[model samples]
Target: MAKNMYSLMLMDEVVSQIDRIAAQSSTNRSNLINEILADYVSFVTPQKHIQNIFESISAIIDDVAALTVQDMAASSVICIKSALSYKYRPTIRYSVELFSDNKSLGELRVTFRTQSAELLMEITHFLSLWMQLEQHYISKFDSKDSISYAIEQGRFKRTLMYPKNSSLHNSDEVSKAIADYIQMFDEILKGYLNGEYNTDADVEYRYLNYLKSGLTVI
Candidate 1:
């Protein structure tokens, strides 16, 4: 039996960066990275097969050209593009609401086609960086686009990052919003599998562990 599928090491620079990001974002760094990992799932789709599947779902959205497979060469493009945009950290969860399907509140597990281990690490790295930035801005820092300083007075009003807006807001509101996005993502996944699948619909899948750990955005 293999033990510990992944290894962990502490680098000083990473820790320092994490601290700075944590201070700026008002997140504790660990949570920030977790959020990023959750969002990366949206980008996990392969380039080649996306169109074949999307072509199959053409009837649901009533797009006549969707059946043609000509436009599908637009690799990595999804019909619900915005749902996977992930502009902000929390927005990943918010994306679940865009779907029309209704799945029972159980669990679903789906797999992406695999090509060994090359791309997964790259995805993880990019997502980790973005997550740190999102956490800092969304939770801790207030941004300013324009500069305001007194040059003539021989004094500089340093740009300040305000620390406000603690995470004391209502919990239920957040939960419902997250649930909506999850539902929408589920709907999209259900649609994709139905289109692409020839195997049994009830097949047990290992991807369910992801939902249990945390959801990711593409």
Candidate 2:
């Protein structure tokens, strides 16, 4: 979206109301007015689009998991909380920040936290192994062309680029992708922790099964 400077005259009462709402929403007067006009014109604002994406994600994972949204400082940032299937039920936080110019794609940061040092160690090792497995997995699906991942400590971050031409541009598809990725991560981590999957082949098999199941299972 592009911006242009425009001068407008508004009634004092109307301006006051806008200011009140803007204050409550933690946004400035100009941005709030822009958002209001965008909504009135049926122009999908980036904030609304990202909100829809997060809502869709919550709906999809509700069947087999829990989802919670955290208070955020800005509309551009969305934070979601969920639990993994690991012992003690480690929590996972997903923080998505939308690009200012595009609403359909953003950077997704996944953070896993647990008090157990043993579990933390296992998760750290699993993250490294996951990178290798995902290299092949991504190449298999050809999705590597648009997405990339990096890890540090208990965090795994992904840069999502959903071009307008791709299926991921669909909000439903984007939600499914997020849900599936987190579910798969939890499952693979559990498998490793339980000693059910140790080798690359075992992880590969698990990943295949996960995809074949249409990402419906835990």
Candidate 3:
């Protein structure tokens, strides 16, 4: 959304009340006021879209065992936290930032963290292969360079475009995409780290099995 500077006059009591609410919410006064005005105007802001996406994701993955999804913040830049399947159960953070002009599309970031050097190296290898697989798979949809991944120290970050297709016109479609991505990623990573597979072919086979089994969350 485009922002503009505007001068307004308000009563002292109203300003003080807004300040109190802002302090309690741990948000700056300007942001608090913006949200209040956006609500009053019935604008479907990016923050609202993000919240809907998070709710949908929660519903889709709620049944997965040993998994937890949390909304780190209910704002335009929504950070979602999920527990990955690992020795120490390292957590993955999905920071979703939506563009106000297009509520159906956004940037989805998958971030992983672990302390062990060995595990980190293995994860990096897995991420590289995963990137190749996704690139090849999405190419069938005529997508070009829509997914990217990077690794630094103990963190692995994979960024992908949400609603890869603009036709994914609703919150449900976007939510399903998010859930499906997380499930596929978790399954393949755990399978690889658990010594269940050694090659890309094996991973493909497992993923196909997952599709046939109609399991989108694990």
Candidate 4:
């Protein structure tokens, strides 16, 4: 969306209320007004599109026992929290933020905080392996250049790309793909750390099976 500056005259009371609502929603006055006007005009703005995707994801994950969706005031972001099946049950946070531009879909960030050096090292290793598997498998259908990844001390981030199938024009399919990916990642990571997955080949087998399950990949 191209934004331009324009002057419009409005009542002080109306502007005040808009400001209040914008503050509550964690957005600026201009953006709130733009969204309101866009709604009135039956136009789907980028923010609205992101909101629809997030809502669909929330609904799809609502029945999953392992994940809890947290309410966020911002429309562009969704935060989901899950616990690892390890000592002290450290919590892992998955934050998904969609972009407003067409360059890319969004970003998925997995973050874990722990005081145990061994646990952190294990998680870091798992994340590295996860990236390698994704690159090896996902590259068969999509360009490896389309995706980007980063691993920090306790956080891993991956850029979400648009699905190869152009027929998926609705938000529901996109949301389901993202939700399923997150669930698979969480389950696999926990399994690897809990010794359920005896070797890297075991993890690769599970991931390859998921890719063969005919689900949309992002």
TM-score: which candidate is best?
A: 4
Estimate TM-scores for all models: 0.20, 0.80, 0.76, 0.94
Better model by lDDT, 2 or 3? 2
Residue range with the least summed lDDT across 10 consecutive positions in model 2? 137-146
Q: Whose lDDT is higher: candidate 1's or candidate 3's?
A: 3
1-218: candidate 4 lDDT, tens digit per residue: 78999999999999999999988899999999999999999999888988999999999889899999998756888999999877788899999999876667889999997778999999988888998998888865553346889999899999988766454447888799899999999888888998999799999998888888886788
Per-residue alpha-carbon lDDT of model 2 for 1-218, expressed as tens digits?
66788999999999999999999999889888998998999987766776677777767766754566677767767677877576778887878776745433678788888888887887777877777766665544543254578888788887765543355555677667767776677667767777899876797788878767765221
| Index of the highest-lDDT prediction | 4
Q: Which prediction has more favorable lDDT, 3 or 4?
A: 4
The CA lDDT of each predicted structure is: 0.31, 0.72, 0.67, 0.87
Cα lDDT of model 1 by residue, 116-203, tens digit: 2443342233334323433433333332222122211111111212123323122233233233333443443333334432222221
- Regions more than 4 Å wrong, model 4: 165-169
Worst 10 residues of 4 by lDDT: 137-146
1 or 4, greater by TM-score: 4
Query: Which residue segments of model 3 deviate by more than 4 Å?
Result: 71-74, 77-91, 101-104, 142-145, 162-165, 208-218
Q: Give per-residue CA lDDT, model 3, range 1-218, as digits (tens).
A: 77788899999999999999988876777878888888899976666666677788778777876456675554556555666567897777766665554422556666776677787788778777776766665544433334455656655555545333456546677678767767676767778887888777898787667656654321
Q: Could you report the Cα RMSD, in angstroms, for every candidate shown?
A: 23.2, 3.6, 3.8, 1.5
